[model samples]
Target: MPLRLPPLPALRFFEAAGRHQSFKLAAAELNVTPSAVSHGIVGLEEALGVELFVREPRGISLTATGADYLSYVSEAFSLIAIGTQRLPNHRANRPIALSCAPTFASRWLLPRLPLFRARWPKVNVTVDTSHRQVGFPVDGFDFAIRLSRAPVAGSAWTRLFGEQLVPVCSPGYLESLRDVQGTPLLSNATLIHVNAASEDWQTWLEATGAEHVDPDAGLRVDTIQLAFEAASMGLGVALGRRPLVNRDLESGALVQAAFNTVNSATAYWLVSAENADRRPELLDFRQWILAEAAQFSCDTSVDAAAAQ
Candidate 1:
């Protein structure tokens, strides 16, 4: 007997619409107009002989039938994706593309990436540095390192590391603020602020009881990397997130203006599409990254204990 199925295009439209519960959002996901999505769903409903959605002026909502059908449709798509990925490929040069924040990519991940390459010489890796949140499969990234207070929805998330905030500056910059008692007065120092992380400076100051320093007065930069560069050039002191400044501090290019470091609410997380674990290369990368993070965390703890 021949298989009975609705048109693949209509089913795809229905799945997107049902998942989002909005025709407009579904159209955006499918890169089609709302009218096209509406027409596709209409055809799908006619073929199925049932009402799938309840239309509203503000937006559409899936009916009980549509909600029930979506579960099965979603599972079918997952199965198809897994099967497709499992197919043998002659090409051995497929690269794993990863997205990360510019500062984290340059100051942290890139410095450590050579180690990964040494361990997995056969694997090809590509890194994209941007502040924008990755959309996983849609954005064509195999994995993403997101700095957020919480994990993003609709993906598998793993916590990589937490962050600490500290005021950092070049040695020359620090010396310029020394008082008669040989103490650096942060209140008299110029501040360099990261536009996206403006609160970090304030948070650190408040935690350290340095309320005399004005957090609002500073030269603002778009990224943490730029702020670090500005600070290194003797422009101003910057609130450096620990992970991004580790190498600089170790190399003596940057130093803590004060010994106080405060824990930050944000942390780095590794995220991938819901079914990305099915890919062997992705699994290998995940394991390697997790192990690296574990070792780094242990080293950081040891250093902190010694400092105390």
Candidate 2:
């Protein structure tokens, strides 16, 4: 008069099949044959005394009971994942929550995320994209990618990269902005501004001596990448940052209007809680990220040579 539970193997097989809706693909993932997967599912169904799947030659479909049971199994597997992640020598089995400005994530890191995943797939990444200043230790983030002109005060900070701002637009957009003296002017299109960096546009205006132009009068965006994207789409001219839009320039999505680049003291920095060093995952991640930075240096050298 007691209820019975399906074996782990059978439940796993069912979960795989339910996920892919194909016994053969599930078999491939599990390194078993389609027939073996089917047999396991059959055993599971018999044990539960219910039909779990709608069998067909093309593929399998989950029945009502199968769907309901699959949800429970999926949750159980998730807990197992969390448990196994807690094992020693691993980054905390908990998700590695990261915070960064949306612009930085989209323009720079998102493009290179595949490399990060390939190197550390087990480290669960949860990104918080906000433009506001987040208190690093109080906000519960493993690391913070901050866009600032000054170093984060009262925190352990490391400079990730330096930034240089240049005037850029699409090739066609630049052509339109070109004058009789071949000076690329900002008379055409809307000047995109990252409202967060009020000094950026003013600095460019001062360096170029475009006194007649209003630095604040244009489309305002909160992030540098948005400015780049607007320029790319011919929305207007933008002050492109070297580290953020270098790849975009190389890819022809954007074109530098002039070689005049001003060094901006502000740059992205990596910061973490004071106690972050105590965790193995945090330490491993820091080392891995630093290694990635080294690789970028080598790659840039190779690219420079290839450009010649």
Candidate 3:
């Protein structure tokens, strides 16, 4: 059977007009003149065989039929949008989807995303927050920023950055703990830990040769963001990623508890299957990421050199 659908452009015009209740406002939003909006609405109404809006000096109002039909039109538009969004290659010029940890997405990738957009305006980028674990083809993901000790058994991995862990607490937490005398200020507050990095406390203790420090203590958090929030709320000390928390530190929302930090064996990696690795969009993304990583390495090197 032949599918009969209304003209998308005309439907869009009516939807906008109905939503704003003003042709002028709709025209402004659509970047068209009032005459264009009026013409589009008239065309839509003519095709539908019903008046959509009652003209008035004060403003326009929906007719009884217009109000009922408007609901269906709005709903139809929303469904069309969802269908188009998820359709493969619907974005036209660029269709790429990458998944990564939420904290990484917000703290690292989002700030740098504009550069990618400027460079490849036609390429559409979709970012999904998976909190560090994803299953590739099964998950409908093109690529993923994975955090692991090393390469997965059967998967190829490109090392992106090393893990650098440091203690952080809110400014208020530090001020409150500063004057208190007890079994060390740290013991008085709850320590926030990421459950994914289950052995983090033990690993830190072993590396620092402070084995006596209890590994099981304080508030346990399941995600990096939650740990950060807890620390920011003056709830406890949190082990934070230096790069991720750099902004908060600079802004004085969070402060480092100690200068010393441990570099863990685990690293953040860019992982994808064989087919995905060869994709043009993936290739472009990989090149962009590697370039940014190189810059970050150089910056860190210079900082370390200067500190000496």
Candidate 4:
């Protein structure tokens, strides 16, 4: 007996629409107008002889049958995606494209790329750095590094390392500050701020209970990198994240202020589309990156504990 299935386009429309629960969002993902998505879904419902969605004044929702059907359709697509990656030509000489924040790319990943390349000489990586949170498959990234406090949905997420704020400044600047027992008089020194992390200084101050420090009294810069550069020049103290400041600390350009390390709400996450591990390059890179992130986390933890 011949297999009975809905049209491929209709199925694609239904899957995207169902996944997003908004025709407008689904349209954006499908690179079509909202009307097109609505029409395609209507056609699909007609062909199936069942209403997939319940129309409402405010928005649309998946019916019970639609929810069940969507799961099966999504699973089928995932399987097909996995199978497509298995093609011989697909695995050969393809660079794993990575999307990440500019600051993270500059301060952390760029320095580590040499290590990744040495281990996987055959697998190349093309990194696109921006502050924008990119979409998988649509944005054409094999993987993305996101910094967030919340769990990622519609993708496979691997926690890399949590963030901590350390007040760091130059050795010269440190000598000028008065120390009370071990902790520095942070309120007396000039605070440096990164516009991107505008609240970080205030947040760190509150976390440490140094309410005396005027968070607003700081020289602001556009980026964290610049903030660090200024702090290293003895201008003011910049709140440095562990991964970003490790090199500076090692090089003796910056010293950590004697204060309680402020634990941040966010962490770095390695994210890829669900079931994207089927590709050899992605799998290899994922394995290698997870290992690197683990080691980094371990090293940073030890350092933090030692400091305390």
Candidate 5:
């Protein structure tokens, strides 16, 4: 007696399509035409006696059944890759591919990456910074760092840190203010805005009871890094995430315009595929990052206590 299995080619095509949510992109990846990918999926559906995808005007989406099947297939593929990499003759040269938010990457992670490299000399790391949501194994990422109210679906998530928004500006900018302690100061001062973040001047102003400030009046930038840069250059006051701006504050490049810091609902989350824990390198990175985050939290608590 022999065990039955899905056709390898069909399985490969289906996995790629399900991962990308598009037959066209899957076809490009598999080096086949879209029609071929479609045909392969049809053959797979017929063989399995189930439709895997729902066709749409904009793109294709996995059916409920397809999504379930993809999880198993993705796990199997990941395990196989892990096994292959662990072979005796194999070299440990593969870099851990991490997808992270642009602002977090530029402001926080990049500054600390050298520490990781110093600790794990043999391990390599590659980072891709984007605001787009990652699709796990299909996207070929080992891990991702996301800023969300909660964990993302279909992957393990570890809460890295909560965000505290504070109004920050260059020392020169603060010195130039006519009345730093005046209620009219916020209303009169120029504001710098990070377009994607929800913790804007309006939220900060409302939290700090500084309703006189016009929330919408400011220069808007696409990333927090840009807003920080603008603020550092004395362009305007930007709402800074405490963890991201800690180093700048310490270096005197920026100063808090006020003592009003409000915690945001969203936090940084570390996300990875279902089988990520089974991989040694992923586990190492996870442990290391969590430890670093814990230390950062402790340091922040001490700083707050001292300030109080």
Candidate 6:
């Protein structure tokens, strides 16, 4: 009598597929075809005598049985990862892979990365900038930086900084929105929208009680970085998110179109697997980032006080 189990490869496919919820994305991660991932999942389901995924026209979702199995499978993989890393030949031998959002990566992380490198010359850092909410061990990332109002899903999270939404444009562009009296003219400016159903312009307007600019009318884009870039080119006034926009504002490449700063519920957070803190490099990175966040918070407070 032997303990029956599915093929290891099929199990891997199931785990990745469940984590990604898309066979195509799982295939890309595993360097295989989507059909292969789909087939492997089918085979896995057959072996377990239970349907793992509820396949729908738009996408697939886990059944109750599938979700339960996924938890067990994911935990097992995490345990295996911990065990393998503790091996004498494998310990501290891999690059610290970080999955971070592209906008945050460019605007905040990359700029401060040099200091981390300077502090820890031996630590190898690999950054994945794809705009996807990745899983922990399954996704092969040690840490992530997420921007959300709610707690970071699927991982432990530490608050980084809250956002201040301020309308901004280039210094030269600011002069164009005046009636020769240097009086503010919000309607005269185009609103560069980095809209993700968030309707940032509308949020800012409602928060500040400003009525001149039409939130619906603007140059629409998808990312905060792009909107600011367009604004820097003297195109229009973009809603600048603080911390992300702090660098550009400091550089004088962008100026506040209005003096109002609307506080947002969302904040940047450092997210990680439950066991990720065991790694020395990860611990060091966490410490450095926390310190940076604290300093930024202090600076923001000082700026606010000065404005008042």
Best candidate according to lDDT: 6
Best model number under TM-score: 6
- Candidate 3 residues lying further than 4 Å off, grouped into runs, are 1-94, 131-133, 136-138, 179-185, 210-213, 305-308
What are the runs in model 5 whose C-alpha is more than 4 Å off? 1-92, 180-184
> Model 2 over residues 1-308: C-alpha lDDT tens digits?
88566798988798778877889877876789999999999998898899999988777899998899888887677566545444675544677777887767877777777777787787777788854444434345678887676785678888776566788889988888878987776655567888777457788778767656677788888767678878898988888886678888899989987666666777677887655686766787777766766666566556546745
Q: Return the lDDT, model 5, position 242.
A: 80
In model 2, the runs with Cα more than 4 Å from the true position are 1-91, 180-183, 187-190, 208-213, 294-308
| Candidate 3 residue-wise lDDT, 1-308, digit = tens | 99887787887778778877888877866779989999988988898899999999999988998889888887776665546545777544546888888898898888898999999887888897733344334334667887778788755688888766777899778766664352235545567888987347667656766533466798998888898889999898888785777778889889976555677778788887445654577788888987887777677667657755
1 or 6, which is superior by TM-score? Answer: 6
**Of the pair 3 and 5, which is ahead by TM-score?**
5
Query: Candidate 5, residues 145-224: lDDT per residue as tens digits?
Result: 88889975667899988888988999888877647464326666899988878767878877778866788988999888
Cand. 4 Cα-lDDT: 0.83
lDDT of 1: 0.83
Candidate 1: worst-modelled 10 consecutive residues by lDDT: 130-139
Candidate 4: regions farther than 4 A off: 1-88, 179-183
For all candidates in order, the CA lDDT equals: 0.83, 0.75, 0.75, 0.83, 0.83, 0.85
Q: In lDDT terms, how accurate is model 5?
A: 0.83
The backbone clash count of each candidate, in order, is 0, 0, 0, 0, 0, 0
Order the candidates by TM-score, highest first — what do you get? 6, 5, 1, 4, 3, 2
Local accuracy of candidate 6 as per-residue lDDT tens digits, 1-308:
99887898999898888888889888988889999999998988888899999999999999999999999988888788767656676656678888887878888888998999999999988999975657766567888887788784557888989988899999998998898888868889988988673538888888888876677897998788889899999999999988889899999999999998988878888887665777788889889989988998999999988987
Q: What is the TM-score of each predicted model, taking all chains together?
A: 0.73, 0.61, 0.63, 0.70, 0.74, 0.91
Better of 1 and 4 by TM-score: 1
**Residue-level error in angstroms, candidate 1, position 294:** 1.0
